[model samples]
Target chain A: MDSIIFLRPTRGLAALNLRDLWVYRELVYFLMWRDLKVRYKQTLLGASWAILQPVVQMVIFTLLFGGVANLSSEGVPYPVFNFTALLPWGLFSKALSDAGRALVNNRNMITKVYFPRLVIPVSSVLAGLVDFAIAFGVLVLIIIYYHFAPGANFDFHFTPALLTLPLFLILALVSALGFSLWLSAMNVIYRDVGHVLPFLTQIWFFITPIVYSSSEISSKWQWLYALNPMTGVIEGFRWAILGTQSTPALLLIISTLVAVVVLISGLFYFRRMERSFADEI
Target chain B: MDDIAIRVENISKSYRIGTAPERYRTLRDSITNAGRHILAARHLAARLSAGRSDLARSPDPSSHSTIWALKDVSFDVRRGQVLGIVGRNGAGKSTLLKILSRVTEPSTGQAEIHGRVGSLLEVGTGFHPELTGRENIYLNGAILGMKRVEIERKFDEIVEFSEVGQFIDTPVKRYSSGMYLRLAFAVAAHLEPEILVVDEVLAVGDAEFQRKCLGKMSDVAQAGRTVLFVSHNMSAILRLTEETLVLEKGRLAYRAATPEAVDYYMAAGFSDAGERLWQASEVPADAAPFQPLALRVRDPKGRVVDTARSTEPLSIEVEYRLDQPITGLRVGIYLLTMRGEYVFTSFDTDDPGKFEQHSTRPAGHYVSRCTLPANWLNEGRYVLAVNASAFHVKRYFWDDHALAFNVDATGAPGKHWPEPRLGPVRPALDWMIETL
Candidate 1:
């Protein structure tokens, strides 16, 4: 039998209801499935749009920076170098925007039903993983084409570091979800978060070492760059996939710490603001 | 104590009025407001330090802006009891449900539930237009707090109940509106939670579906689950709930068996006196020169009564004080059934002769009375709304369903049938039946 439950106005800092979330885990999965299906439904291009987004960005970046500006690719082909970073960068930006708008878009559900509210933004971030996987497939083909192309001169090596790719992908997921939690909660109250999100993702894209290599930044500022969380994710992806640069252990550690802080604080803020969502939204 | 499935104690919810509805203050607005508050606090501190007593005597500023949507409302429901909640719009019925469902937090007190709660505050709440009907059933089921296994077990029953078996795989956007409503309601009806909370969502479906929903509710009640049903349809309430609660201005006005509570609510009107007396504070400032003094239903002997026998004439009287002369002003009354079906609207000047005589009366106090002849109304609760408006110009004051009364059929025609008749009016039509 279910035990008695008492409800009252929560006070002080709001505690995350992990048990409630566990019970409603199926809702999270279903919501994620809905987002994935709806994203490709009725569209002419369908899932191909996912592969196209990152591939198109890689082509433009390789042209503008590698071909036109004569920027160095650290002995790796510029296309392979930029494409590796763009894989994680694409996931970060897409997940951020999608999860940020999740709450306001589902105001009907939020106001009308009772579930773990965290499922909304969390599912949005999880839904982006499907697109990320599709885009990742294209990156692998690009790597293979460059490896076997005549006179490619690409010295690609697979190392044990490839096994750590999932860890870095999870890191990217955490950072995106953390930021989205804050943005989605604020979007319910301010509504300006929706308007500011695109601009935010654009500015975030430049600072994450996607278009250019992180080596160009002075070693002194590298620690500050790691504070962005995605810095470590992008650099970690390149090291794991292309074996371009040695792993930045210090940067990865700092980024992981920063990601944890963001996630913890974002969860608290989201739960704190959740009580007013139905009333405000 | 163990028999009680739900207990609510002093649950109150207050909302800040005179602000943008459902809009939160933007970050910039909050920053500016905080800055102003801090500056004001500092100024007050300086005055206090200077030994000025006046500065310390002011009340808290926030209290003036808030309005209580529910005030110290307390109630309980035993296991297997189906309770109906009836109230006028904005009487905090929805707020109470939101608080109970945990969609929103109450401002004060607590509600304790002894079992799992499933609330259908709205049907099709999380249905995605792009998703197929099958997918939406599972999605909506989970949204209503049903477990995945439970939804899976009930999937076939839900589809059959919805009568959408052919379109189960098709996206709901392709389904007609009736099919959509049916599918949504089917998912909600199949949820077997220990307690169910429903709002006024049944009115969305057609009449047949409504009867089906009421039947399902009774089934749930018979199965020993507690239910909280809020609706404006009194007949449904009468049919389903054993006991009912009446809310008046956010307070629990009456709680009794369904029939008695419905009777009390119908006759209560804006006050317990079966009359609506507009106090100075209750009237909006803009309704100047058109202040309604009082409104009441009087028996044939000219005494205020909440319930009138259908066999006699009943008079509805509205008294108003106009501070200035007004032209083309018509004071009217609208009679409607308890289910919000309109019976008729009659203006004091509806007769052209009266309209011509009162075209432009000078400033004075006046009373407008309209009488309904005997045998004109059915045996049921009816609502009366008063309006003051001009022809095609502007409406000064309008209250929809502002007052309510009951018309009892004690001596009306066909009282021996023992079954209630339908429709707003139940007039006796003479019939001659020969042995032919």
Candidate 2:
């Protein structure tokens, strides 16, 4: 009797092995770098599109919220406030959009070549980070202009909490990678997932507090918001840079756990579905 | 055994066959199955008189069903050996290569490969149409698992081989299909992996390019690298591979030297009368609107002639059944070379007196005869197709492949036909020089 391997919802967790990914580190870097260069190739603005995105969003939000809605910026310039929130959100949204369908975009590669399938979505997310880097440079200039010097009164005190920025950025990366892995893998067999990605991202953006601060949500609901993962990341980013009341430590703790959980489980599901992608695609 | 570069062990893969017209039907069935599975688990638990911890801990694996594309297939190839895979369409050749390349997992077994693999499963694979040819080369190389520095080292060589120097910077989307195939093949062939796997992608290019690619594969194979080639072209396969594996419906039918395997494949799919015709419908006819009766050769008595002597007078007869009378009709015959090029075309009206008017159906049969002047066409297999059209041939209605035959010059005991005449068709021509 031939033993059959059941690879589905239950076995997904064991199907993905991180060691295989590590073995192909060079491929991952090449794929990520290739995506980064391709995104900016032949463009007149090159890397400026990254900074341009959040800066443009900052101007719009400053006018609409600061100018019209009178939304408080915690005694800081609204442009910087809005730009700060937009940075991580920009990274998350773009990463999600690209990674969500990376498998379909590379269907030729999947069907013809052999490699770690996770590398496709991982590279897409990393490529989006290039835009984040270019956009991050512009944010630093705005911060220098508004605060003049780092201090408590300027609401721009640099603190040791800044060390956790990488941690938070990684959190956002995990959330995007996790969700995109599932989406991209599913998109290979069901094309309708591609059509729904944009609408789902829109809803996801609103729920992440990119245009507003998470502080204003009712305290009773704050814990549930942390379950979103990005909720803690955005709040943590604000805390690290602005030195505001440190993001509710408890929410940060909870969201970090959620992000880890999503990353592992998402990878599991993606690998389980990947074996059939070439045939179906 | 030490020299073996690829070893396949009991590999199997299966897929669920689905119909596009019933796509929704199967989809709904799967959803309903999922619901039933959940409900049945609960029902079984409730019916149990006592709790069974051991049974609850495990799940059955055989409950699902699928059709196996490959089953228990195993093979071994030595390093530097050029292996040819030949089979009818859908015979699992592509599936085997996919498994060897690790593009998809084998359900039951494993293939252990000794070195890096460079595979070109199909044209335009691993190529992004929006990317320029130069960009795609790097992208494809990376995707093929080539190191960046290694790709850069051979990048110029690939461009030169493809003969697309001028269009290297242009996006591949704008390139002609031929140019796309050339450039894509260049990148794949030049990658210089330890093992190269090529599918039927070489079928699209011009004969010259195909010759160049075949030459390259031979050179690569000679360089002590392994190659697994899959193609329908028997002559090309014989020219390139030393060993051949013939597959039929996902099972190994024959494995031996190229010539023997080629013979097996030919005999398996063909009949002894030298008539290789399998499915007449699949082979496109030279004429479209007419149903072909038979294309044969005959002597003066009208008895079907199966063979012809080189020096003997022969009549090529093409018979087709037509439903209605076509005015000013000219019956055309074309002889095509083995490489699929038209060598010559002759019509029944080549001689003025040969044109006959048809006011009604020739009550019994309609036959077009082309008389071959003594020893004109050389000895070889020639395809004879008859076409019906107006005298001017402004619009063609039908062509029938009524006959295909071979001419042997063996009747002249002391002579041998020239080697170049081994092609599908051979024509004797006139060569004259006028001195001024």
Indicate which candidate wins on TM-score: 1
Give a tens-digit lDDT track for model 2, residues B42-138: 8778767466555543233444546577777888889899999988666799998988877877766677788777787875566776788998888
Q: How good is the docking of model 2, by CAPRI class?
A: acceptable
DockQ of 1: 0.65
For candidate 2 chain B, the 10 contiguous residues with the lowest summed lDDT are B270-279
Model 1: residues >4 Å from true position, as ranges? B22-24, B36-61, B270-375, B378-382, B385-400, B404-428, B433-436
List lDDT for all candidates, in order: 0.87, 0.74
**Model 1 agreement with the true structure over B151-213: per-residue lDDT tens digits:** 999999999999999999999999999999999999999988899999987878888988888
Error in Å for residue A119 of model 1: 0.4
Model 1 lDDT per residue over A106-219, tens place: 999989888889999888888888888888888888889988998888966779999999999999999988998999999988878888999999999888888788888999
Worst 10 residues of 2 chain A by lDDT: A1-10
